[model samples]
Target: MIANVLTIAGTDPSGGAGIQADIKTMSALGAYSCSVVTAVVAQNTCGVRSFQALSPDFVAAQIDAVLEDVRIDAVKIGMIANAGIAGAVADRLTHHRARNIVLDPVMVAKSGHALLDPEAVSAVRERLVPLASVITPNLPEAAVLLDRPDDWSVPAMRAALPALMALGSDHVLLKGGHLEGEDSTDLLAGPEGTQAFRAPRITTTSDHGTGCTLSSAIAALLPHHPMPEAVARAKAYLHAALAQSDALDVGQGHGPVHHFHALWASDG
Candidate 1:
C-alpha cells in the first residue's frame, strides 16, 4: 500500500517551496500527498513579497478534517508563521498521536526572507519540537532556535548538535549547506548517537526548496524504512533532484529543483 503523507505549511505560488514543494517531494517519493495551507505567500524564486496567514482555529479545523478520515503514515510541517499556528499544529499532532513527524524549522527563505515570526520561535521550540520525530534545521535556523549567532563551520555544528537534540526531538539533522565548502555535510544526532552525511555541493541557483523537499522526502520514506535509512534515501533523492536542477527555468531568480527527475528520465 502507498504511504499517506500530509504537509502542514504555507503556500508558495511559485510552486518551488513550502506546501507545493512538500507535495511534489511526497508524490515523487511514491507517497500519496495531502496538504493544509497555513499561510498564503506571494513569492517566487527571487524573494517573498508578502504573506497572509490563516487563523489558528482554521488551521486546526483543517487538521481535524484530514485526521478524522485519513490514515496518515507521516506528516511534514513547514513555515508556521506564529505562535498561535504553531500551538494549533502541536495540539493536533499530539491529539492524533501522529507518526513519522518531520518538522522543518523553516525560519528564512533561500533569498533571506523571514518566513517565521520572531515571537513564534519559542512556541515551536517549546510546543512543537518535542512532538517531532525528526527536526531539520539549517545552520542559521539552528542558531536562531538556540538564541545565538549563526555558525556554519562543521565543528560549530557538531558542538551545537547535542544542544539541538535537547530541545526535545528524537532526532536532529543540522544542515551544513550554509557553510562555505565543496561538500555539504549534515549531522544527525539522536539517542543512537551521531551520523554524518555528506554530498558534493551542487553549484546551481535552483535550490529554492531544498529543505522542504528533503524533510518531506524523509517523511514519505519513514513508514517503510528506519530513521537512518529513511534519511539516507531522502538525501540520495535530494541529490538527484539538485543534480538535475538546471533542467527547469521557472523564474528569473533561483529556480526549483526538478522533483520528478526520475520519472522524467525514465525510458519506460
Candidate 2:
C-alpha cells in the first residue's frame, strides 16, 4: 500500500524548502502527500523576507481535520514557528495517537534567517521531541536544543547523542553537515546502539531544502521499512538529489534539489 504521509510545516514560495519541499520529497519517494500549513512565509533562495504564523487554534483544527479523515501512515513536522504552534501540534498529534512521527527541528534557514521563534525552542524540545519516533537535528540545532556549543567533530557528535536521546525521541539522527569536511556524516542513536551514515559531501549551492527533504523521505518510507532502513534509504535519495541539483536553475542564491531526478532520467 502507498504510504500516506502528512507534512505539517511552514511555506517557502521558492519551493526549495518547507511545505513545498516536504510534499515534493514525499511524492518522489512514492508516498501520498498531505499538508497542514503552520505559517505563510515569504522566502526565496536568497532568504526569508517575512512570515505570518497561523493561529494555534487553527493549526490544531487543521491537524484534527486531517487525522480525523485520512489514514496518515506517517508525519513529518518542520518549522512550528512559535511555542503556541508547537504545543498545539503536540497536543493534537498526541490526541490522535499519530505514528511514525519524524520531527526535523528546523530553527533556521540556509540563508541565516531564523525560521523558528526563540521562545518556541523549549516547547519543541519539551512537547514535540518526546513524541517523535525520530528527531533529526543538525549541529547548530542540536546546540540550541541542548544549551551547549555546537559539536565540532564526530567524537563530539557521538558524545552528544546520549544527551539528545534523553530528549525523549526514540531515535536521534545528528547531522554533521555543518562541519567542514569532504564527507557529510550523520550519527543515528537508538535503543539498539549508534551507527554512522556518511556520504561524500556534494559541492553545490543547490541545497536549499535538504533537511526538509530528508525528514519527509524518512516519513514516507517508515511504513514499509524499519527505522534504520528508512533512514538509510532516505539518505541515499537525498544524496542522489543533491548530486543532480545543479542541473536545475531555480533561483539565484540556493536552488532546490531535483526531487524527480530518477523519474526524469527514466522518462528521458
Candidate 3:
C-alpha cells in the first residue's frame, strides 16, 4: 500500500523547507502527502525575514479535518512555532492514536534564523517528544533540547545519547552534519543501542531543507520498513539529493536540494 504521510509544519514560500519540502519529499519517496500549516514564513534560500503563526485552534482544526477522513500511515512534524500549537498537536495526535510519528526538532534555519520559539522548547520536549516514534535533532538542536553546550565531537554525541533517549523518544537520530569532517555521520539510538550511518559530505551550498527532507523521508518509508532500514534509506535519499543539488539554481544563498534527481535523470 502507498503510505499516506501527514506533515504538520510551517511554510517556506521558497519551497525548500517546511510544508512545501515535506510534501515534495513524501511524493518523491512514493508516499501520499497531506499537510497542516502552522506558520506562513517569509523566507527564501537566503534567510527568513519574518513569520506569522496560525492560531492554535485553526491548526488543531486542520489536523482534525485531515485525521477524521484520511488514514495517516505516518506523520512528519516540523516547525510548531509556539507552545500552544505544540500542545494542540500532541493532544490531537494522541487522541487519534497517530503512529509512525517522526519529529524533527527544527530550531534554526540554514541561514541561522530561528524557526521555533524558545519558550516553546519545554512544551515540545514534554508533550511531543515522547509521542514520536523517532526524533531527529542535529547537534545544536539536541544541545538546546538537553540544555547543554553544543557537542563538537562524535564521542560527545555518543555520550549524549542516553540523556537524549531519556527525553522519551523510542529512537533518537542525532545528526552530526554540524561536525567538521569528510563524512556526515548520524547516530541512531534506540533500546538496543546506537548505530552509525555515514555518507560522504557533498560539497554544495544547495543544502536548504535537508533536515526537513530527511525527517519526511523517514516518515514516508517507516510504514514498509523497520526503524533502522527506514533511517538508512532516508539517509541515502537525502545524500543523493544533496549530491545533485547543484543541477538546480534557485536562490542566491543556499539553494534547495534536487528532490526529483532520479526522475530528472531518467528524463534526461
Q: Measure candidate 2: CA RMSD.
A: 1.0
Q: Rate residue 211 of model 2 by lDDT.
A: 97
Q: Please, what is the TM-score per model?
A: 0.98, 0.98, 0.98
List all candidate RMSDs to the true structure.
Answer: 1.3, 1.0, 0.9
Poorest lDDT segment (10 consecutive residues) of candidate 3: 259-268
Tens-digit lDDT string for candidate 1 (25-96): 999999999899999999998899999999999999999999999999999999999999999999998999
User: What tens digits encode model 2's per-residue C-alpha lDDT throughout 1-268?
Assistant: 9999999999999999999999999999999999999999999999999999999999999999999999999999999999999999999999999999999999998888898999999999999999999999999999999999764799999999999999999999999999998999999999879989999999999999999999999999999999999999999999999999988989898999999998886434
How many clashes does each candidate structure show, in the order listed?
Answer: 0, 0, 0
In model 3, the runs with Cα more than 4 Å from the true position are 266-268
Residue 105 of model 3: what lDDT? 92
**Candidate 2 wrongly placed segments (more than 4 Å):** 266-268
lDDT of 2 at 261: 95
Q: Compute the lDDT for candidate 3.
A: 0.95
Across residues 1-268, which tens digit of lDDT does each residue of candidate 3 receive?
9999999999999999889999999999999999999999999999999999999999999999999999999999999999999999999999999999999998998788898889999999999999999999999999999999874699999999999999999999999999999988999999767899999988999999999999999999999999999999999999999998988889899899999898776445
- Looking at model 1, residue 87 earns an lDDT score of 95
